[model samples]
Target: MSPLLTVEELLALRSSGSPRLLDVRWKLGGPPGPDEFRAGHIPGAVYVDLDAQLASPGSSEAGRHPLPTAAAFQQSARSWGLNSSDTVVVYDDNGLLAAARLWWLLRWAGFDGEVRLLDGGLQAWKEAGQPLATGDEPAPAEGDVTLGEGKLPTVEVDEVPEFVENGGLLLDARPAGRFSGEVASIDPRPGHIPGAVSAPATGNLGDNGRFAAPDVLRRKFGDLGVSDDRAVGVYCGSGVTAAHDLLALAVAGFDADRVPLYPGSYSQWASRPDTPVATGPTEPPLIDAAEARRRVAEGAVLLDTRSPGGREKTGPIEGAIIVDRDNLDAEFDFGSAERHAEVASLQTPIVVICGSVNGSGPVAQNLIGRGFVNVAHVEGGAPAWHELDR
Candidate 1:
């Protein structure tokens, strides 16, 4: 079954009410998901608390977002009105990042019915001019779905070393910074599993915040060494966003059943002192302000990702190419007639700078994922560059 449902497909499905709709909106920090759901949601969509319904109480051993027991998940599914043979559609505001968890869990729990993510998620729905319903959905009829465990393959914490040793490609789905030990926000330690390749899940998305085309994803994974003959595994800070990578793989025509998930992920691995954590990208992808200036002087394209107001406030760098940071993919799409000619070649030396590293880092990683051969971000972004000049 296809892993995603377009908004038009969902609109047709909604009229029939044949599928169970789950709003699994969540973010790492900030306004609560339930609050957002209550404010406005797809009609008949039940809110699913990622923390309460989707995950078990976490420990250092199980990781931050450990899978719930089968019985627990079955109960939660029932509450959401899942039926034995009903189709299920899940969505979130943040692309499919949060919703894919529920889709993977449903498959993992042995749901025989089709389960798919709403492509591009809530934003897509809204952008299509679809109407949203406010307030809690009416309580659904208790469902009779029976769930079984181990429907999907998984790698336990102890099996990580052996898996990597035996030639399996273990992909780290966290942002590049976290994988490189440059930043460790929630994990017990920085760096990644010894032998894991950095493949941030966000890189799976196009500029529209939807999963990239299957061919694009196939090339992306192929670039990272994924192939039919090789075994592959994926993990993130916890187990959650890693599923996003798995979903992208499925969309890219890989067998979803064959690839395994490391449920404990880095959180569990890092908590154990016995585990080895490796840091640094194979090549340094971050450049200092001076290096960025030098590269720009030598004809490298400097991408200024600051917003219009921000650029006005900070004063634009004379020769920088200003593109909408949120829409970088469109700007860099070489196949499009609208593609930027200045950095049209994949081999072009591209330096990205934003207000700070927080904005620039992911953009740099994203470009690299999109097959750009030479990409880097200013370590401290525009402010740092200006400070260095001073």
Candidate 2:
């Protein structure tokens, strides 16, 4: 069990030059750069932009935040002085939300050294009356960390069904409301992966924007059915916020398998008709017999769009695979898989849906723009699950 360093321990490390700090700050739907860090930051800390470091620079094929090539990401990390010997503390002013982006990056880059988050980030550190620095920062002394090769073990939209059937854990880090599909917010899809555990990123922080104690986090995660050692997979709207939960799980001192962050997540899953989804806030929608039959016969897949709790009661149509809307078109088979450069002679058929009739419609619109043909949707979603009967 790795123990979360106390504030005092961190203070000593900073004073003793044990850790190198990296401040990661980002705004939703903004261009990629480090304007925030240029204004002011922790002394000696470099900046890691969420968009640049975490996301790949493409939209058509790779989903947003497609895991960067390990070598390139490693070069970025090394340029910032993130090494195996020095403790790397990443922080952001917006609570743990943004700093978590870098914390997860360290793990992905295979820096198995002292990696921790500055509790409350810049705000809490300032509120606690810690020191501050400003102006263009300098890079680290040496740079040499190999970015290992191999798939980071990400499960596909179709794999969640078996994980749930086998009783593995699926965690969602979106806010509770969006998790319930009550508010879709940014993504076109309305719900979550069926049978996913809804543990909002907010739950891991106190009002101060800092992380809770290790014991508190341990108990909280334990209550949510996450064991110290489990095959845990996590996701957010588009693979962003979920990193916060992964960091907190790391902080809780739980021995666990290498957790995979689902990159496309809700945004990609919601877009395609072939992907299955669910709705509402009760049933744990999953790939059971009923959903499979509906999908096979109806030509639609189960789309789990509600929060995990909602899907608990509804379950999912059998063979109904999960898909999110944001990054789906990039990953979908939009007839482009075939070598037909003749500009899609016949229309590719699809059904747009979220957790309801309202959910899957707009997704259909995005698909239409992307050259999809015959786009339709599942009727009534979760609210009218019975509509599938007839």
Q: What is the C-alpha lDDT of each candidate?
A: 0.85, 0.63
Off by over 4 Å in 2: 1-7, 30-33, 58-61, 139-142, 149-152, 228-231, 282-390
Query: Taking the tens digit of each residue's C-alpha lDDT, what string does model 2 give over 1-390?
Result: 342344566689877875777778886765433776777777777788777776777352344666677877877777776666767777777766877766666666667776777676777666667677777776667666656534345766677677777878888887655766766456656776777767777767754556767876775576467885667888887777888888788788764337777777777666655666665442222233344344446443333445455566666544444555555544454454632232232122233334665556566544433433234455566545545565
Which stretches in model 1 have alpha-carbon errors above 4 Å? 282-390
Candidate 1 local lDDT, 274-349, one digit each (tens): 9988976534267789978987886679999888887878777878888787887688888787778888466466
For model 1, the run of ten residues with the poorest summed lDDT: 279-288
Number of the top-ranking candidate, with lDDT as the measure: 1
What lDDT is obtained when candidate 2 is compared to the true structure? 0.63
Local error of candidate 2 at 259, Å? 3.4
**C-alpha displacement of 100 in model 1, angstroms?**
0.7
lDDT of 2 at 71: 75
**Backbone clashes counted, model 2:** 53
Worst 10 residues of 2 by lDDT: 340-349
